[model samples]
Target: MAGEQKRFARFFFYLRNLREAALHTGARAEEAEDRGLELLHSAETEAELKKLEEADSDTLSYVKRGLNRIAFGAVNDAVKLVFDADNMTARDIMGMDLFNVSEIKISGKNVLEIKFFDRQKALEKLGELAPQLDGGGESKRLIESIYGRDGDSL
Candidate 1:
């Protein structure tokens, strides 16, 4: 039982980190890769991450918590459940944060836009997760920023 709880918690943390990273990626295409690295660093165990968020209740919106809770609740006992069953619920998708993020069924691609508070981080995620756009002008700028030509990627 405890293991299940812990897994659920970890799943939520993964969701949070990925969401944060994705949102950051969308927000900062100019410095995409660094933000992607930061997203990697921010990944932590679910319980610790959950506590961290709860501790910062004053900074983030209550709706985020509500969303988190909803997501987490849907994915309890992940270790015991079949892997494909993870996507059967919205909370599962949201809490997991990455499983169906880009592949999410959308009617059109020309007008898809999801904003975030940290643009650079979001940009990094965009580069990492959605690589098709990485060869274009903005991607070139992002690569230049991350590689610094003379600088480096973390």
Candidate 2:
């Protein structure tokens, strides 16, 4: 039926958007697709669109947290600690907050290499989301909380 087709079209639209959101928040390709499919399958009613919108907000928050961790978190000290294997124990390595790290490898000559998520890309994504977050709504409240009513600070 035409109605069913239209509904399915709308569902796919939301799914695509959610998947892009997940990717912008630093999810792997497969992970983003899975999240989108899960969210689409979970919402069976028009009213459930609200839940999808809430999920977008959650994704934005996740992106922001990742950006901050990469930009301001203790990467320098963490890398130093990692390189100083003699001073670091397994428990210390396990306890480290490496949320900003993307990859770790032992390279040629036993060189330890660590890769971090791209901070510039994260900032660019946040810039893209800024206009959406500035629009009046829950996103506006989030912006206000972070940057203040005058849009100063942070």
Candidate closest to the true structure, highest lDDT: 2
Q: What is the lDDT of candidate 2?
A: 0.58
RMSD values for the candidates in order, in angstroms, are: 16.1, 13.2
TM-score of 2: 0.46
Backbone clashes in model 2, listed as residue pairs: none
TM-scores, all candidates, are: 0.19, 0.46
Task: Report the lDDT tens digits of candidate 1 across residue range 12-68.
Answer: 443444334333335353453354444444434345556856654542334334344
Model 1 — TM-score against the truth? Answer: 0.19
The superposed Cα distance between candidate 2 and the true structure at residue 75, in angstroms, equals 0.3
State in Å the error of residue 42, model 2. Answer: 39
Worst window of 10 by summed lDDT in candidate 2: 1-10
Give one digit per residue, the lDDT tens place, for model 2 in 1-154. Answer: 3333334334443333444434444457669657545544553533355554565565555555556556544464358656796688889787555766889888898778888888788678767776664444666678788899956775
